[model samples]
Target: MSKLDALPHGPEFRFVDELVSLEPGKQALGRYLVKGDEAFLVGHFPGNPLMPGVILIEAIAQLGGVVAQSDPEIAALKNLLLTGVRGAKILGAAVPGELLEIEATVEGRLGGMIQVSGRVSTAGRELATAKIMLSGEE
Candidate 1:
C-alpha cells in the first residue's frame, strides 16, 4: 500500500494525489492536480478559480505526515493532526490544470509532536512555503 494510505483522511479531504518520493522519516515529495471540477472552486471565485493557499499548506502537511509515519524507528501515531503552522508565505496561486509539486522534510520530533518544513511549487514556480507542526495521540 502507498505510504499515503497511512493518513486518516478520506479521498475527498485527502490532498496528496501521488507519493513521488519518500525517505521515511527524512522527507517526501508528492503531487496533486488542480481540477476545475472541485466543489470549492465554484465559490472560490465567480469566474476565476485558484487553489486556496490553505490547501497548499494542507498538501505539504499531508506529505510530511506520510514521511513521519513511515519512519522505521518510530511507531505510527494515531490521529495525527496539523496542530500549528508558522512562517507560512503564499507566494503564488495555482489555477486549474496545474500540477502542484509538494515537498516536505521532517525537521524534528518531540514526544507526540512532529515539526516539518515544506514547499509547494508548479512548473518551477513556488506557490507556498511553511513550517508546520503535527501532533498525534500517544
Candidate 2:
C-alpha cells in the first residue's frame, strides 16, 4: 500500500494515491489515478462517466491534509478534518484513466486549524481550485 493509503481514510474513500512531493507547512503535490471501475464511475453517468466535482475537492483537501500533517506538530495530533471550503471552481471534467495532479499551499494556521489553497489538474489542464481549512485533533 502507498503512503497515502495509510492515511486515516479508508480505501473506498481515500482520494490520494501517491505523495509525489512535500514541504512541511509549505506545500505538497500528489496524484490519483481515476480507475474506470471505481464505484463512483458506475452511476456517475450511464453512457459517459465523469469524476464528480466533490471528489475533486476531496482529493484537493486530502492532499492539503498530507501537507499540513507533514509538520511534526500536526502529525502528532493524529487527526485532521476538513472544516471549511471557499472559492471553489471546477474548470473541466476529469475522466477515468486520467491521472489527477493535486497541489496545495499552506496559507496560515489558526490554533489547531490549518488553512490552505489547492488546485487539481490533469495533463496540464485545470480541473478545479479551492481554499480549504483543516482542523487538527489531539
| Strongest candidate by lDDT | 1
Candidate 2 residues 14-46, lDDT tens each? 888888988876898999999988898889997
- Top candidate by TM-score: 1
- The alpha-carbon RMSD values of the candidates against the true structure, listed in the order shown, are 0.7, 1.7
Error of 2 at 12 (Å): 1.1
Q: Any residue pairs clashing in model 2, and if so which?
A: none
Clash count per candidate: 0, 0
Off by over 4 Å in 1: none
Which ranges in model 2 have alpha carbons more than 4 Å from their true place? Answer: 1-6, 73-75
Measured by TM-score, how close is model 2 to the native structure?
Answer: 0.91
lDDT of each structure?
0.93, 0.86
